[model samples]
Target: MNPTEFLDGGTVTVSDETYTVYKTEHPESAAFATIQDENETTVVAEAGTVSGENVIESEPGWKRLTFEMVLPFELVGFLAAVATALADEDISIFAISAYSTDHVLVKEEDVPVATKKLEALGCAVER
Candidate 1:
């Protein structure tokens, strides 16, 4: 795929809800995203949604920005370009790739800069 074609004409939507990343011992059904391995469970859900003894740590106030395009499996460097753009601005991101598209979680305070960086890459960002 052409890099320009992959970068341009894509929509990135900022979610209205704030999320939290949690490291928990148990699964959370309400989590927006979850990953479990032999040692731990990582959960990303709405802020203040998950609690109790199972949760080992939590990082709150993250906002999700979703790439609204259905990416082809063979497409490459899409995320690398985005990550590099943001990294240049010193913005950290937690990325999640679903079957159809990709999402990135940025600290609430970094949304504006992150949006601008993504926009610079030719993505139409909706906040």
Candidate 2:
């Protein structure tokens, strides 16, 4: 496989738990969904603190992974390649795919090693 370029780099740590969908305005729409744990669920009116600037609810118990990539967009097995690269370093990832690109969230503990692995794979690491 040819090595790819990553303009921006980010890594977030999440837990082993599953995330359930919360309030979705369109109800049946929105390519990306917001989720939280059952017990940790609650609604908030303030928008500035959370992403998308909407009143939303979530469980902070989990972690967040954020990546910034310039998009003309290429789906070209990016996730699988990243997964394999992370796996080679014994790091696990819980990934989410958005319209523009992919986000891979791993344990914060594994971040340094993951960075090294990604760098080794010949992708730019934005530290």
Candidate 3:
């Protein structure tokens, strides 16, 4: 697919809730979503989950921005554009892609900067 076609998924929305990333052992709770890798389990859970001695490390104060369109399975460069835009401005991002959509996480303090850069790329941002 053409690179420009990637941005067709429009209107990225920033989630109001704050998210914390935790490095921990396997979390058995199904109440929250968790992703695991061999090195550590990355947990995106309620603030309460950050507690407990099981957490080996943690990064708090993250905000999520989700692209609101159903991206085509074959599309490419969607994330690159967004990430590059933020990176150019020295904003860091943690990105995730599911079957139909993409999500990006940035430091809570950088939400405004991230949102503005995305808008400059012609993406309507809702924060």
Best by TM-score: 1
Answer with 2 or 3, whichever has the higher lDDT: 3
Clashing residue pairs found in predicted model 2: none
lDDT (Cα, tens digit) per residue for candidate 2, span 1-127: 2225442243333323433333433222332343345544332212223444432434322223444553345446667777887898888776766676556666656767876776676555554
Per-model CA lDDT versus the true structure = 0.91, 0.50, 0.78
Cα-based lDDT at residue 111, candidate 3: 92
* Poorest 10 consecutive residues by lDDT, candidate 1: 1-10
Order of models, best lDDT first: 1, 3, 2
Clashes of each: 0, 0, 0
Please state the error at residue 117 of candidate 3 in Å.
0.6
In model 2, the Cα lDDT at residue 48 comes to 28
Question: How does model 1 fare in lDDT?
Answer: 0.91
Which is better, 2 or 3, measured by TM-score?
Answer: 3
